[model samples]
Target: MASTRIGRHVKAPRATVYRLLLDADAVARWQVPTGMTSQVHEFDPREGGAFRISLTYDEPTDTGKTTAQTDTFHGRFVRLVPDAQVVEVVEFETDDPAVTGEMTITIDLADADGGTRISAVHDGLPDGVSLEDNELGWRISLGKLAALAETGELP
Candidate 1:
């Protein structure tokens, strides 16, 4: 298993960022990487709540974990602290053994100079997932999140 940590500073208040983190609609808008669209099949904003989402590539040439052009994932909220932190246990919806595993994602928010500082930790990456690709995807997604948070508009 592998792990990664990513950090970013958003020019928005922690409360605003936190709200976006828990909002299913907002997630669909900002949680996706560039060239991909996200669909939230289910979401429940509370500890122990379960959620399912899918990300589809705009270009069919891209490979997918769940299908030819999409990657689906389902998870449960392990912990939730209003405006502070969120932890989730996620698993890819796939039959490929190399990608089968439970991953833990933790997001921590803190007040920063005139904004919020976001710390994201992703652990338990399966062997099939490339670290560089995962980091790039997260950087893209977090950039979208920052844009949305700073402008209050979908990116």
Candidate 2:
């Protein structure tokens, strides 16, 4: 299986970063792109806990009808270490032909000079997937997380 890893250093405490990662409400606030909204169908934030995120991408329609494309993500938490690490297995459920895979994502945080060094590793990608695109997406998402933790604002 293919694996992609990305890391970012955030100017926030490890505890704060961990909380932001596990907080379902806070996750919906910062995990998605600007203008896109996410709803948590279920979130437990503990080992063996179930989690799901339904994201709706809204686009303006020229025909005056609001259009939205909805995608649902189902996953379970494999491990949870408060203020240190979280590991989850995520599956993408979509009819799109281009995307199909189960991803195991691990987020690690370490205390570094009054800040937190966050590392995200995504594994179990299917063949034919572009690592660059996956890495870029993770980078952007993590950057958004950092911004949220630092500024107390969602991205």
Candidate 3:
């Protein structure tokens, strides 16, 4: 299975970053990649809990492997370590065989240099997804996370 690992250092406390990670509203604000909007239909931040998120491209005509104009996914919280780490198993709602599979995502947080250091690892990527595109999307989302966590604003 393919994997993508990336990290970012945010100008916010570990607890704050961790809290934002689990907050459904915060996720709705920043979890999507740039040029996209997100809606969280369900979020339960606990072990074995389930959440569903839908990300829609800004342009209505944009279509994805999952569906027209939007990509929706559902996942279960595999683990949650307060202010430290979070692991989840995500499955894309798609009909394309190339993009069918479960993706395991783990986010690790640490206190460092008066801020929070975030490490994100995604495993079991679909064969159709490009590594660079995935990383770019994560980088954008992480930047948004940092902005929100640091200044209580979205960029």
Model 2 CA deviation exceeding 4 Å by range:
60-68, 95-98
Question: Mind giving the per-residue lDDT tens digits that candidate 1 earns over 1-155?
Answer: 99989999999999999999999999999999889999999999899999999999999899999999999999999999999999999999999999999999999999999999999999999999999999999998889899999997755
Number of the top lDDT candidate: 1
Worst 10 residues of 3 by lDDT: 60-69
Residue 134, candidate 1: Cα error in Å is 0.5
Q: Write the residue-wise lDDT of candidate 3 on 24-69 in tens digits.
A: 9999988999778899999999999999999999988777767788
Tens-digit lDDT track of model 2 for 22-130: 9998888777754457889899988999998876766643111122466577899999988999999997776544456678999999988779999889998756457
The models' CA-based lDDT, in order, is 0.95, 0.79, 0.92
Residue 113 C-alpha lDDT in model 2: 70
TM per candidate: 0.98, 0.83, 0.97
lDDT of 3: 0.92
